[model samples]
Target: MSIRSVITTADEQVPFAAVKERIVQAMCAAGLGAVLLFGAGFSSMETLHNAAHDSRHSAGFPCH
Candidate 1:
């Protein structure tokens, strides 16, 4: 491929690459949120429960 064509192709792919990156980031964030919300929120360990509770309280999430 010519240099100009290669540059054009790369430019065309920029938007697609950015969109894919955003989707992956969003999915990872959601997965992490689920783990923290359910896994830590309902843990049998007192330390985990207290940590989550304190974090929620600090964030003003109203756990009560």
Candidate 2:
């Protein structure tokens, strides 16, 4: 067998448009996940702040 016959060739080619579309979809999914995580964190922080405020008020301490 010849040296050229021993080398394997790539049989598939990816189009630029398909690659771009896949990248855009991945970016949008990541952005949506980040937004949802941020919103959940903000809601937890707000709940904590309200609980602390209520505790302080019940203890007769001025939080302002």
Report the poorest 10 consecutive residues by lDDT, candidate 2: 4-13
> Which one is best on lDDT?
2
How many Å off is the CA of 19 in candidate 1? Answer: 0.3
- Root-mean-square deviation per candidate: 8.3, 12.7
Model 1 Cα lDDT, one tens digit per residue, 1-64: 7888656654355678888999999999999999988986677798887887999999999998
TM-score of 1: 0.49
User: For residues 1-54, what per-residue lDDT tens digits would candidate 2 score against the true structure?
Assistant: 997677756865668999999999999999999997786677877787888899
lDDT of each: 0.84, 0.86
TM agreement with the true structure for every prediction: 0.49, 0.52
Using alpha carbons, what is the TM-score of model 2?
A: 0.52
In model 2, how large is the Cα lDDT of residue 52?
80
User: What are the clashing pairs of model 1?
Assistant: none
